[model samples]
Target chain A: MSDTSLTIRRFADLANPTRFLALSARLLPWICWLTAALFGLGLFYALTSAGDYQQGETVRIMYVHVPSAWLAMMTYMVMTLSALGTLVWRHPLADVSARAAMPIGAAFTALALVTGSLWGKPMWGAWWVWDARLTSFFILFLMYLGLIALNRALEDPTRAARLSAILILLGFINIPIIKFSVDWWNTLHQPASVLRMGGSAIDGEFLRPLLLMAGAFTCLFLALHLGAMRNEILRRRVAALRRQAARGALTAGGPA
Target chain B: MSLDAPHIGFVLASYGAALAIILGLILWVLLDGRARRAEIRALEAAGIRRRSDRPVDDARAAGPAP
Candidate 1:
């Protein structure tokens, strides 16, 4: 077989829920421990890192804020891919992935908003601002919440999956807007520093801790996303079993 | 969180909020997994076996069952 077909077969193998459950079960503990280790190391360095000449100790907030903001966008990007899997490839686990990621994405977005607010108070002298970046991010948070509600409100899994996949794709337009909002408008939020055109403009002292925290946050998201996907598979199994039992009862003239 | 640090309130609050959110997410994932497993176990205890749990032959014999 050609390489493409071989890779496709491997991908198809993982699309099976049982295989996914087994794989996630084997991987979860290692990922969990790794997440813990990264967070511990990241936090230690973030705290011990030298104070900023101007921002001082509050600059530490960036360690958490920036990473959360990045995850908020990155998680949605993952969901967008899953949405494509649902729509085009018709991958069974695709909607499961999109659904599992919603809450995690929302949590990270909320973290970004809250930390940004906390950072804003001292730096921007406002608890909240209607700036371009901030407003766009808030909308992103609302989008996550709205999609999550849609996922729960729909009773039929197939219908829910299809509808959400479309909505997820539609909502993806906000991501780039959020990324470029600072540049497009005169916002209180600073323009991209770490992920910029040329290179990161941040000084090494602050950038090291920030990058480390970003790695930790990414690992945390990975572990959580896998756990969530496993739970979703279990949920589908339970529902299927219930339906099976119901059918069995109707046929056998007894309660399930 | 340092006592002597400047703008300690802001720094502490940011970290505190991040910690609380992360802990909440972790707790929710763990609890959700436990609850779903409990649900499956309950169904099995009530004699409602998933199709996959049955033997391959049994599954085939019960072909096309939901």
Candidate 2:
């Protein structure tokens, strides 16, 4: 075989279910350990290293709420890219990666909402409100659910992939709306501090741990996604093999 | 560290909830992966067993059992 063909063969070999499962088995332990370590450090830093001068202890919610919101947005962006890869390249791993990300993204989105509500009750004097940022966030959660439902609704994997890709592409609209809503509406929620003019409005003592936690969360998601993809490939292989076995049995039982 | 700080309870609650959910998710993915892999392994072994049970000479002899 030519060098190009050899390379393709090697790549296809990795796509095999058994190979993928073996790799995942070797990798998942490290991922789980790192996830635990990161969460531990994050919690320690969140609780002990700093206390808010203004909002006092309640400000600790920032550690969870901000990072969850960031991941929620980032995960959606990653999912859309994966979905595009699924439709365009028809990459075997692409749909699995996208599907794995949805639950994590949905979880983070829900976290953002719950902690936002928790923070809002103290700051805004209400458990919930119809403010632009909050409203857009709510919509984002629904978008995650919608994408998941779209994936599950169709029987054919390829058709499900295509339909969900369209949904995710359309749902990209909510992301920018979520980011810019506070600025556009002059709402009660504070405008961007981390990404805005000058520098972050938050202090360094608090910012360090927040950034660390965000990095840790991102890594955790990466590890989980890879593991989930391995499982998906294994499931597909088992289904294929079972069908083959059934066909073999049928043929064996039939008359000439 | 500041025991006297107001709303410390809220801070504790937020971290607690985040930890609970993340840990739950991790457990779920790990268990589900293990279960699926086990199923595949079992099915594969069964396929092998079936294949091994057939005699080599019967390969042509088993053609439709006429």
Candidate 3:
């Protein structure tokens, strides 16, 4: 077979939950190890780097706070794509992926908020303020929670998946606002220093470890997401078996 | 690293919170997988297998639903 076709064939195989589970089982262990190693390296850099003249030692908090915030946003983007997969492509694992991503995204968002608050209290004089940047990010976090709650309240998995997909897409308007709030509004939150229009405002002194931490946290997100997907697939399998058992019981019994 | 540095407590608290959240997520995923696997094993052991797990020949022999 041609190489392009062969690759396409391999990619197509992952649409099967069993195949995806097998792939995740093989990939997750290595990703987890890589995440740990990268975090260790990143931490070493973060600790050894000299403190900022203005921010002093408190700057180290950025190593954790920034990455968590990035992951919080990235995971939601992931869900947005998974939402498309469910609505457009109708892939079996699309809803599974979206459902699995919600809690992990929520956790990361919570981590971002907690760590941001911890960092804020020292620098900004207050743990939080009703600024555009902070308020929008907080709303993003709440949207995740709302979608999670919506997913759980519905009885049928199919209906829940469809409704959650719509809600997720509807809720996605907050992402760009969160990204641009520092620019659109004169918030106390510092303007985008890393991914700004004219390149990073941060110096090389701090950028290295920040990127490493970002990489590590991204890997961590993938590791957790894959494991969660595997578990969801298995949970569905268990549910299917229970339904089977119930049907068997009904069939074996006489009509009421 | 300096214990006496200004605002060091905030840095420590942030890192501590990050560590706590990461560990919680890891445990949640791990324990959830374990519980599901155990449940599947119990169900299969009780002769309650998935329709896909049943053979096509057996399914054919059993015939259609009433």
Candidate 4:
């Protein structure tokens, strides 16, 4: 097989819950340790880094705010991919992963919005404005909530997964809008400085801490995602066992 | 880290909120994993077999014969 096919096969093999569980159990501890270490280093850099000449101490919020925003978008992207996995590939873990990620994604998005508002009150002299970027981000949070609710509202697991997958794909359209809102319109939120066509406009002193914190947040998300997926898989297993037990009881109580 | 910066409350609030939300999420996931694992252990101890734990051919043959 070609390298690409080999990689695909390996991923396909992970659809076996037992293998996935074993892999997760081995990796989760290391991922957790890495997350803690990264957060420690990231916090040191963020706290000790030089203050911005323009925003002064308030720039400190950027360390947390930017990472939360990045994770918010990134998490949704993950869900979108998982949705594709469920719909196109019929990968067993896809729905579980997408479901497992929703709460974490919602939390990050909420953090982003709250921190953004906190940053805004001081900078923009208003807690909020219906700017394109901010509004789109708010919509992203709502989309996450909607998906979570829809997942719960359906009775059949297969049906829930299918419907939610469709919704996830449909909701993905908002991501690019959130990313380019500032550029597309006159928004109070700043345009892309770190990620832009012409490269980052941020100073190195601030950039280092920002990158460090971003790494920490990314690590945190991964560790949490893996942990959540493990839990979800176990939950499914428990449900299956319960169903089997019920069947066994019915059989024993009946004519046999 | 100075206490006297103007509008510093906003910075504190923002960081506090982030810390609270992130920590809460971590705690929630951990507790949930622990709870589910305990429940699974209890179920297994009560002699309930997982679908995967059953022999495949036996399960197939025993279907509707339980």
How close is every model to the real structure, measured as TM-score? 0.96, 0.85, 0.95, 0.95
State the displacement of the C-alpha of residue A37, model 1, in Å, after optimal TM-score superposition: 1.3
What is the i-RMS of every prediction? 1.3, 2.6, 0.8, 0.8
lDDT measured at residue A121 in model 3 versus the true structure, 0 to 100: 90
Candidate 1 lDDT for residue A122: 92
Candidate closer to the true structure by lDDT (higher is better), 1 or 3 = 1
Docking class of 1: medium
Which one wins on DockQ? 3
Better of 2 and 3 by lDDT: 3
Q: Tell me the tens digit of each residue's lDDT in model 4 across A1-256.
A: 8999999889888999899989988998898888888889888988888777778899999999999999999999999999999999999999999999999999999999999999999899999999899999999999999999999999899999999999999999999999999989999998899998889999898898899889889999999999899999989988988988888799889975
Report how far residue A216 has shifted in candidate 1, in Å: 0.6
How many angstroms is residue A248 displaced in model 1 relative to the true structure, after the best TM-score fit? Answer: 0.5
Stretches > 4 Å off in candidate 1: A254-256, B64-66
User: Taking the tens digit of each residue's C-alpha lDDT, what string does model 1 give over A1-256?
Assistant: 9999999899999988999989989998998898888898899899998888898889999999999999999999999999999999999999999999999999999999999999999998898989899999999999999999999999999999999999999999999999999888898888999888899999998998898899999999999999999999999999988998888889889655
Candidate 2, position A49, lDDT: 73
Clashing pairs in 4: none
Question: For every candidate structure, what is the RMSD over all alpha carbons to the true structure, in angstroms?
Answer: 1.8, 4.6, 1.8, 2.1
Order by lDDT, highest first: 1, 4, 3, 2
lDDT of each: 0.93, 0.80, 0.91, 0.92
